[model samples]
Target: MPASPSAKIRANVPIPLSEKAIATRFVSFSGLNDDKEHIAIIYGSPEQQEAPLIRIHSECLTGDVFGSQRCDCGEQLHEAQRIMSAEGGVLLYLRQEGRGIGLYNKLDAYALQDTGVDTYTANEMLGFAHDQRDFTPAIDMLKALGLKRIRLLSNNPHKADDLVKAGIEVTERVQTGVYVNQYNAEYLKAKVDQQDHSITLKQN
Candidate 1:
């Protein structure tokens, strides 16, 4: 539909993660408009598979690095790694912190959320859109990897839709495990209610 993205691979190095057994390579790209350091974690041999599993994970600083249970990001990331490690897939770790609102804004939103508001409402109150992430760069990264078809690993339908719109055929959509705790229950509910994420969670 649109012009093909002209992104190119900058570097790809095989780096063993802390979980030594999960073999992966960190792939860097150049020529994105935002110029952020977004990377792709390749596990096994995706190019050799007919439809490799792929996850377009936005960067979550607090939840991902710090193991914050306020959200399910950290758990989901590790789950992706486990799946990709065994089944062979790709992980496009986008530099879209806090749904593209940036870290500081997200922290501010967190303050609002602590006051019993939904995640989306907090952003709206701050004069920002519910989800400000741009998946265009992800598409470009996929193109650079020469992936025409994939099996998407995500609960959000938007990820699959965006990939299809950008000429990447999503052959299947695999839902990630729902890691719901007391803290993140409402947060998960907001996502399911607001964005129609495909997650079935019983009330705790």
Candidate 2:
């Protein structure tokens, strides 16, 4: 059986505070239904009538926290903050590790990937879907914040689809791209090929 909605855990965690010269406001909350800790950096004036730009990024402890280069999570996050700070929007950092498979299993999948398996194949071997995350909590949180619509920042079409389906009007999709290095080339390809993520690689 699928896990119950309440089985998901949530916690309030502080992000490493930033002192950069950007207009940013930090907020943290937990998703009780999904049990995910969430941190947000709100940029721009919330009173602006324009549709707020938002990014619902799932937590990647290895990549975001540990500076692992096997994937572009950390880079994408930094890019999100940079853009949002400049343009005005919100960065919703969701704590769904490994696309909701949790930490230990994600590490296990990493070991499998190191042995020549791609990310999709590794997740399958570990009895998981290619992406097990759901965006319902994001929708709820946006509503709670009184955001009626947003220009979403993402390369994944499904994120737009999911938010729209959940009644959050997505006005536009803002692309977030990063350079592909030797460490994350295969991983990025797996995202494009297997997950059908719409990522544009930086041209040499």
Candidate 3:
């Protein structure tokens, strides 16, 4: 984990999500790379808890906002919200679209995927790494929230490894729900096979 610049709370506002019927605290941060507005959707009073549940979710415009079935990002985001809303947690929504390769490049990679290449291979064909997401911003966000330790809600082991390297103690690793659809079955399998994401898929 590389050292990132320290972040501070830029703004905090209470916004009620109509679909989930959950009142969340929308927090934005300052002093990050790219000057993009990453958000921290706070479900409960994590500052009051010993080890709050945390999910460092990367942005997925197609999947998260438009509900694209090509990936499980949207499902995972909602699942995190459902659990955190009840159990008290912080969802750090990092603006790392397309695993940090940017949106247009991601679409180009998608075109390559349509030609029978896996996601990682498509990225490689475009001269990008398999996963370019930098977790330093996530560390900065966590530190800004005054969280020294947390129960990480994710299936990605890299997240835990990065946090630990940055001196943030991950108390527990909780797996998110495995959302397998016909459109994303290959994508999900690639995650488990290539990246070692902790997921169990149905054997057909």
Model 3 gets an lDDT of: 0.90
lDDT of 2 by residue, 129-176 (tens): 988887777776676566868899898889999888777889999888
User: Which candidate would rank higher by lDDT, 2 or 3?
Assistant: 3
User: Model 3, 112-133: lDDT tens per residue?
Assistant: 9999999999999999999999
Q: Any residue pairs clashing in model 2, and if so which?
A: 8-34, 8-35, 9-35, 9-36, 10-35
Candidate 1 lDDT (Cα, 0 to 1): 0.91
Candidate lDDT (C-alpha), each:
0.91, 0.77, 0.90
Candidate 1: Cα lDDT at 48: 92
Per-model TM-score, in order, reads 0.95, 0.85, 0.95
CA error at residue 89 for candidate 1, angstroms? 0.8
Clashes of 1: 0
Candidate 1 lDDT score at position 115: 94
Superposition-based RMSD of candidate 2 using all C-alpha atoms, in angstroms: 4.0
Would you list the rank order by lDDT, best first?
A: 1, 3, 2
Best candidate according to lDDT: 1
Choose 1 or 3, whichever is better by TM-score.
1
lDDT of 2 at 33: 57
